[model samples]
Target: MLAVLASVFVISMSGALMPGPMFATVLAKSYKSPWAGAQVSLGHAVVEVPLILLIYFGAATILENDITHLILGIVGGGMIIWMGLGMLRARKAYAGGTKDTPYNAFTAGIILSAGNPFFIIWWATVGALLVLKIADYGLGGLTALVLTHWAVDLIWLSIVSGLVYKTHRLWAPALHEAVFVACGLLLMGFGGWFVVSGVLAIG
Candidate 1:
């Protein structure tokens, strides 16, 4: 059981630590609030709760559909690109540290989690495996599985946002602009990739 839980943690962290739309969203928002990560984590949970239930109900088959991936790729890709543009436009807007971002951390979390096709796909494949492995132990195991998986997200996001918050606390305008630009570009790149892949797949 310990081994199962431990493996889940490790696998969860591997995904959480990867640079993706969600990570970019967190980075884009951390400029204004150090607690963005926690807020985002809550938002992530909002989506995840339903996802966990879906896994229990064997929803992976639906998520694995090629048409499903293509549709999500297009729709989600557009949203991510829009988000990246927002970031780029707001790159310097947060310098004063008083205004709120267009999308709050929580909303960004929800949107990114929902919009990122890879996220859904991961849940379908890797997430399903983790849940099934632990679900065999019954309710307690299932509970641990959810908590452990989310815990990894929470811890990693908090640390990242916290560090960014602290760094920006010094009000390094140059660093702020540079990082936001980089993050914005990164998101745009990922968005483009998703769209292109989807298009190619469809063709």
Candidate 2:
């Protein structure tokens, strides 16, 4: 059980560390207001907790349904592309200023995290894997997996917020914009890939 739990923790942490629109948003907000970025990160994880539980508990049956995976894949992919586009648009508006409010970051984090489609697919797949192995470890594994995943998220957000707080003055607007655009492109590329893969799987 301990080994299984440890393995899941590592997997969860690796997945959380993968850069995405969520990470970019956290970093951007951190540059403007570190506290706000932290808040946003917390809110994002808060939303994810229930989702992970749902997926873990339900994926066993959920994955068996073609319709479920199809809807999830399409929705998730579309959402990533949309968020990438949004970031691109936001580049100019937020580049030079700290005027963006914490509430804005909080709200955006919640909405984007909640609406993200790729997360849905990934969790659904991973959740199924957990469910299969869950019986081998019982409640202890479950608890550890959940805790470790959230901890990773908190740590990542803190790092972003701390770095921005410490170095915001030195960070140039152009560099920020460039980062945003690059992240946006990466998101769009992944989204497109998901859509294509999902379609191929369905066909």
Candidate 3:
């Protein structure tokens, strides 16, 4: 059990530390509020909880379907690429002192997450495997896995958001722009990969 929990923690952390739409959203939100990442993580939990349940209840088969993967990959990949471009555009607007309207960080989290096909794929594959391994221990194991994984996300994202908030004043505008640009590029790269994979699957 301890080993299971530890494994979940490590794997979850590895995912959380990856550069993706969620990370981009959190970084963007952190500029406005240090607690934004927490809100985002909570929103992430909203999607994740149901997903975990579905996997536990044998919904993994549906998620594993090639058609499902193809559709999600195409749609989600396009959305991610769009978001990346939006971020790039936002940088110029931000430099011009135009601020975006206030929105719920939680919602941003949900939207960003739901729009990422790679995220869905991960749960469908690697996450499903983990679920099977842990399901042997019953509901207790599932619960621990969910909670531990979420806790890791919350902790890591909170730290990132807090650092960005705290250091915003110390960082130059150019530095901020560069970070945003880098994130945007990474998102586009991921999006492109998803699209290519989807096409291959379809073929």
Candidate 4:
């Protein structure tokens, strides 16, 4: 069990460090809320908890189907692209400064996460395997997996967002826009890859 927990933490932390849609959102939203990382992680949990449950109950087949992946890649990828474009459009608004929108980062977490093909794919495969393996140890192992995953995500995301937030005061208007643009483009790049891969798979 200790080995499982440690392995899970290492794996989750490695993945959390990757520059995914969530990471990009963390960078952008950190300016709005210093606690954006925790908020986003909570939002992500909203999707992840249910997903883990579904997988636990034997829904992995449906989740792993090629057709499901195709649809997820197309639809989720489009949502991510839309978010990237939205961020670009709203970049100028930050120049005037902004307040915490409360649910802003939270919803971004849920939506961006739900729309990420890689997130879905990970849960469908590696995550699903982990779920099954934990099942043998009963509910305790399963609980550990969920909490462990979330904890790793929370820690990593909080640190990243905190650093971004702390340095935000030094950003010039141009720098703010530049960061937003970079983050937005990063999201679009990920979306594009998912979309293209999905399309090719369909062919």
Clashing pairs in 4: none
Q: Give the winner by TM-score: 2 or 4.
A: 4
Report RMSD (Å) for each prediction in the order shown.
1.7, 3.3, 2.1, 2.0
lDDT of 4 by residue, 8-102 (tens): 88889889887888898898888866899999999999999999999999997777677776877788888888878777777777534653222
Clashes of each: 0, 1, 0, 0
Off by over 4 Å in 2: 40-47, 55-59, 98-103, 107-118, 131-141
lDDT for each candidate structure? 0.82, 0.67, 0.80, 0.83
Q: Which stretches of candidate 1 lie over 4 Å from their true place?
A: none
Candidate 2 per-residue lDDT over residues 130-153, each given as its tens digit? 645765576676777777667777
In candidate 4, where is summed lDDT lowest over 10 consecutive residues? 94-103
lDDT at position 140, candidate 1 = 85
Q: Put the candidates in TM-score order, highest first.
A: 4, 1, 3, 2
For candidate 1, give the lDDT of residue 48.
Answer: 90
Models ranked on lDDT: 4, 1, 3, 2
